[model samples]
Target: MDTRALSVFLSVAETLNFSRSSELLHMSVSAVSRTIQRLEEELGQSLLERDNRRVRLTGAGQEFRTYARHSLDEWQRLRRKLGSDEELAGEVSLYCSVTATYSVLAPILETFRATHPAVEINMHTGDQADGIARVLEGRDDIAVSGRPSQLPQRLRFLPLLESPLVFCAPSADCAVREMVQTVDVSRADFDWKLVPFIVPERGVTKDMLDTWFNNRGVRPRIYAQVAGHEAIVAMVSLGLGVGIAPRLVIEASGMADSISVIAAPRDLGPLTVGLCSLGQRLASPPVKSLWDVAEQTYPRAI
Candidate 1:
């Protein structure tokens, strides 16, 4: 019945850490635990399970998480509807990578804020790999992400920019460059497998690399599989290996002095980076307003 408790429960459910939830809520760990206990007692259901090692949601907890998200969204929607006539007002949680936060998200957020001054923008920045999952989990209203080969049916993507997916090599002499230069195999004999690659550990970047290599009938020799495009830049800058990342990431990395874009194979094409959100989320006023601004500001650069 207590919306505050429900909010606390959702935070804990998302993080799966009592201490983290407490910190996020600006409450003591004991307070967070008590709030969850009270909610569970009210519902007559065991919502979560905890051990010394970690915490996890029980089956009931998963069901309640969905309920809590909708309940909070509806509550906020009602408040906005009743509270304001001249201005639309509500919180919009957005997620993006560090690069996107400055590059793609900056202008979009600025425009959104100017239009809806009463609305709060709760922005979370992290690796691009986690962007869509954040939206799908109901944690973020929207996220900046690259369009995947097969987008989920529940989600919608609006293209913001097109950046070529290019292979990057160390600007200085490196083993990867040396190998590429020395391995003068004929077009028929060219073995991409001979070159070492530093690639993203997950997400569309990894998927793209997998597809590119598979289509070419060669498995790249991975020197490292890292989490972020920035990390790829760092690794490639050190001559650790060649890497593939969007031109946007490279341009924003500030490490362009240390890396150079390699001529990516023709099969590997440009990436379309943009905003992503659940179709359901767009129905919310704050989310819809921001989505409108995004559509108007960046009209499908692809």
Candidate 2:
């Protein structure tokens, strides 16, 4: 069977839409259908159940999808292994937030490119909160993420840098800012409940924030839960509510003048920012190379 057909099948299987898969594969819808038809004919089983309403994978198709992924992975591994030692070449898919793309990944990418010029870096930038989920879902090979409170057994983390998670409020005289200023930050009896809190929509940052609030017995008056720290900073700058974000994000944000860091209690720990990927994926040459370069670029903080 042609590997191109397998690739097309995988794309269609993932989207469950023939038109979308055709667009992704740069093939006409009829051509895409014919390729799948040929594949199914050779395999002697119906792989997909399609009708006007929807498209779905049959049990055979589901099993074939897994096989296709493994086959493609193995083929890429073999190609990389056979490449010239002086010029390593393959594709490496990476996911990271916009801030990280510029702030953290830029330097690492520069170094990696210098070392492995032939390796294609297929990078996707999105909300930092979704980095881990994207990696777990096999959308990407690696992701830049914060160390979650409970690290999963199937994943491996390589610590890069430490950035303290800090509370932020509008520099302007807003309700939360006024309330924050009224009470001494050094005092233990400060009424944290009065302050409205903005937080990440989901992910480790939210997990950390939840833990911090629960530990203090403070039922925070949440104002908003946004997808990214950049949005949180934007909201906080507008005096919508106080928010929590890593210090790295705050520094990278151009709105430093519009927002002020709250003197959060010492218990709010710093985020251990780093590279992470599935333990199984690290065996791939391109993935392992990037992982090693990142480790060398930013050795684990003592």
Candidate 3:
């Protein structure tokens, strides 16, 4: 079992595209294919199902993926332990939304890079809501995420800052804006049922929104359920519907000029944005190095 082959297979399994894996690994597409083929031949099992349209992991591939992740983690851990005195050198995979790349991560990454120049940061940006799940699934070592109401026992959160959850409507003269304007949204008696609401599909913000609606006993007229706060802001900017999101995201979305914040009758508590990772993973030197740098950069109450 060559570690290099395992690395290539793991990359392909994660991306499910030979071309993508090749791009990430800096290998030629044919080389990546050869690596997977050799692994399949040696194991006597087809790890992937490939067609002209898509590539998917077979049942065996899924199982092998888990094994490969653990194997790679263990190998990295062993290397760090053996070279305890040497400067820490390895990769730490981080997941965050695009907004967080500049707003949340920029300063911390700057300080971390200055301290641990040898360590590599492999960042993947997407919906901030998926950050915690990605860390739990071993897809990333750490993620910038909002603290959930009920934190998972296996994970640890390091709070950096608080961003208020705000309800927003279109600033433009549109149907949605007109509906919002008809009622004084700051009052408890406001008719929420009449306003079409754009909501988060899932995540901490969604949980908070559900709680807010339940408390008011208002059955909202849902207009759409979208992923990512940036998308929520974009939709609301186009006068699609009223939406809920963190103020931090709304401000950074670049569409803030087109969106207007609504004064909710009740105070929806602020979201605690922070660094999240498995407790066990923090023991890894490279991951811990970055985590410590973040703690130092944002030294405040959790």
Q: Of the pair 1 and 2, which is ahead by lDDT?
A: 1
Candidate numbers sorted by lDDT from highest down: 3, 1, 2
- Per-candidate TM-score against the hidden true structure: 0.87, 0.84, 0.89
The 10 consecutive residues of candidate 1 with the worst lDDT sum are: 180-189
lDDT, candidate 1, residue 239? Answer: 84
- Candidate closest to the true structure, highest lDDT: 3
Q: Which has the higher TM-score value, candidate number 1 or candidate number 3? A: 3
How far residue 229's Cα lies from its native spot in candidate 2, in Å, is: 1.4
Expressed as tens digits, the lDDT of each residue in 54-78 for candidate 2 is: 9999989988976886777687777
The parts of candidate 1 lying over 4 Å away from their true place are 80-89, 181-189
The alpha-carbon lDDT assigned to residue 291 of candidate 1 equals 90
What would the per-residue lDDT of candidate 1 be over residues 1-302, giving only the tens digit for each residue? 46888878878887799998788779999999999998889889999999999999999998998888778778777776687455776567789899998888888888988989988776788889999998887778899998899999999999988888887788888667787655443243577678778889999878887986676687667888889899999999988887888888889999999987766655677888999999988887889899999888886566
Winner of 1 and 3 under lDDT:
3
Candidate 2 clashes between residue pairs 3 or more apart in a chain or in different chains: none
Per-candidate count of clashing residue pairs (backbone under 3 Å): 0, 0, 0
